[model samples]
Target chain A: MELKKPAMAGTTESSDVMITLRPNPEGGIVIDLKSDVKALFGDAIEKTILEVLKEFQVENALVNVVDKGALDFVIRARMQCAVCRAAEIQFDWGKEDAHGK
Target chain B: MANELMRTSLYAGGTSPVKMIQAGFYNEDCLVYDLEDSVSAGEKDAARFLVYNAVKYQRPAGKYILIRVNGIYSQELDEDLEAAVRAQPDAIRIPKVEYAEEVKRIDEKVTAIEQKAGLPVGGVKFWCNIESYLGVLSAQQIATASPRVVAMALGAEDFTASMSAQRTKPGWEIFYARNAILMACRAAGISAQDAVFSDINDPEGLKKDLEMTRALGFDGKTCVHPRQIDAVNGCFTPSPKEIRNAQRVLEALEEAARNHTGVCVLDGGMVDKPMELRARTTLAKAAAAGIKVGGVK
Candidate 1:
C-alpha cells in the first residue's frame, strides 16, 4: 500500500515505541531509530518494523522509530496502526495478522 | 462454566503497553483490555490494534481475558468487533447495552466474523454493560438474549447519570439496579459483575462498598486500579465459618445417604436442595481460593 499522508502512532512511554511514517515517493524504505537499548535490540527492532512494512507492502516510506523497550507484539501493533493511518484506510483484520508471525 | 473465583476483573488501558504487559502479573481473576472509555477518540484504532496483538500473541495464561469494545451505536463498534473477535479473548464486553436486539445484532455479527476467521461460532462470549435505566429494566432479556452471554455488569456511573441522580459513596441510588442485574443473572444462571468502586485511594470506602456488593450477591466486581484487586478478591472469598458450614452440610447429606434416609438434617435445620446447592458453591469457592475444605474437592 502506498502512503497518502504522514502519520504516527504510540507514545514514548516505558515499554512502548513511538513510530512516525511519512510518504517517500522516491522509493526505498529509510529507518531512523533512537533507542537506549540500541546496542542490544536495535537490529531486532528494526527488523520487526521492516517486516511489518513488508507485510503491508509499504516499500517507499521514511520510518522514524523511538523505542522505549517495547515487546515484539507492541512494536508490530504500533507499526500496523501507523501504516494504516498513513495509507488513509481502515484496518482490515482479515488482511493483516496481528500475531506478526 | 465460567471461572468460579472471578472476584476481580481489572481493567488495563489498551493504549498503555506498560499496563497491558504488567496486568497479567496481578492476582486479579480476569484482565479486561479496555478499548472504550479509557482510550481517546483519535486513538481508537491504535488501541484496537494494540489490544488485538496483545491478546492474540502475548496473551497471559490462566486468567480470564476480556476486551471492552465501544458502545453498539458507536462508529467504532464494527471494527472493534472485527478485531476483538479475531483476537479471541474470553469475552467481548459491550458497553451501554440497553436492549436484547442490540445483543442479538452483535451476536450475529460476531458469529459472522468467527465463521470468516474459521473459529468456533460460539467460542466467543459476551459481557453486557447495563448502564442505563432502559438497560436495568431490560436486564432479564439482555441476560437471556444470546447463549453466548456469560455475564452482565452494572455501569453505575452511567446508570445514575441516566436516572438524573447523584452518585454518592453509600451507593443507595444504584441499589435497585444492582438488585435488578443480580436477579437477572441469577434467573439466567450467569455471572453478575458489579460496577467499579471508582475510589482507588480510599480502601476503607472500597471495603464498605464491597460489603454491599457481596451482600447484594454479585458474582464479581470490576476494578479500575490494581490496588483494588486484593480487596475485591478477599471480600468475595468464602469465610472459614462459611466453608465449615458447607462441609458440615455435605457431611450431613453423606450421612443421610449412608443411612438410606431421604431427609438430611444439620444443626436443627433441614438441608434442602437450595441450601445444599449454596453449600456446594461455597465449598467450590473455597477450593478455588486455595482453601482446603475437608471431604470436598
Candidate 2:
C-alpha cells in the first residue's frame, strides 16, 4: 500500500521510538534516524527500516525515526503502526504477527 | 488460571506500561492487562503492542496473568485475540460474550494460534464476561460451551444499562443477574466472578459489596484500582473465627467417620453430610488463601 497522507506512531519515551511516515514524489524510500546510540547501532537501525519498508513493498516514502534506546521489536512495532496509518490499511491478523510481519 | 483464591483481578490499563509491569508485586491474585474499554481508539494498536511485549517479556512470577480483549463485534477483536494468544497469558478474557459461538470461535482461533506457535494445544484458557441481558440469559450455555473456560464474571455496569436500570449501592439492580451467573457457574463447575465496585474511595462500601458477593458464592471480584485489592482479597479469604469453626467441624466429621457414624455433634449442632461438605470446602478455601488452621496443620 502507498501512503495516503502523513501518519505517525509510537512515543518519545525511553525504550520506544517515534516513527513518522510521509509521501515522497521521488518514488524511492529515504530514511532519517536520530538516536543516542547512533554511533553503535545507526547502520543496524537504518538497515532494519529499509528492510521493513521493502517487505511492505513501499517504493516511495520518507521514514523518520527518533529513538530512545528502543529494542528491535519496539522499532518494528512502531514502524508497522506508522505504515498502516499512512497507508490507511487494516493490520490484518491473518497476514501479520502480533508486531506485524 | 484455576481460581484458587483469585480474589482481586486487578486491572492495569495497557496505556500505562509501568503500572502493568509492576502489578504482580502488589500481591493481587490476578493481574489483568486491559486493552479494551480502557484504551482509546487512537492508541489501540500501540496498547496492543505494548501489552503483547509486556506479557511476553516482563510478566511477573507467581501471579496469574490475564488479558482483556475487545468485544467480539468490535473491529479490534481479531488483533486483540491475536496478540493475546501469541503472548500466552494464563487466560484471555472476552468482553460482552452474548452467545456460546463467540467463545467457540475464539477458542478455535486460540487453538490454531497455539498450534502454529508450537505451544501446548490447551495451554491458554478463556474467561468470559457476561456483560449484557442476552449474555445472562445464555450464561449456562456459554459456561458449558468450552472446556477452556475457567471462570465467568458478571459485568454489572453494562448489564444494568442494558436492563435500563440505574446502579445502586445496595446492588438490587444486578442481584438477579449475579445470582443467575453464580447458578450457571455452579452447574458448569466453573468459577464465578463479580463485577468491580466502581466507588474506589469507599472502603466500607467495597467491603459490604464484597461480603454480599462472597456470600452469594462468587469466587472473586474485579478491581479497577489497586487500593481495592486489600478489601477484595480479604473478603474472599476465610476469617480466623470461620477457619476455627471449619476445623472443629472437620475434626468432628473425622471422629464420626472413624466410628462408622454418619452424624456428629459440633459446636452444639449436628454435623451431617452437608455440614461435612461445607467444612471441607472451608478448609480448602483456607488452605488456598495460605491461612493456618488449628488442628489441621
* Best prediction by TM-score: 1
- Sort candidate 2 into its docking category: acceptable
* Interface alpha-carbon RMSD, every candidate: 1.3, 3.4
Clashes of each: 0, 0
Best by lDDT: 1
Docking class of 1: medium
User: Each prediction's Cα lDDT score?
Assistant: 0.92, 0.84
**Model 1 quality (TM-score):** 0.95
TM-score of 2: 0.84
Question: Residue B128 of candidate 2: its Cα lDDT?
Answer: 95
* Predicted structure 2: lDDT: 0.84
- Candidate 1 stretches with Cα past 4 Å from truth are A97-101, B1-4, B260-263
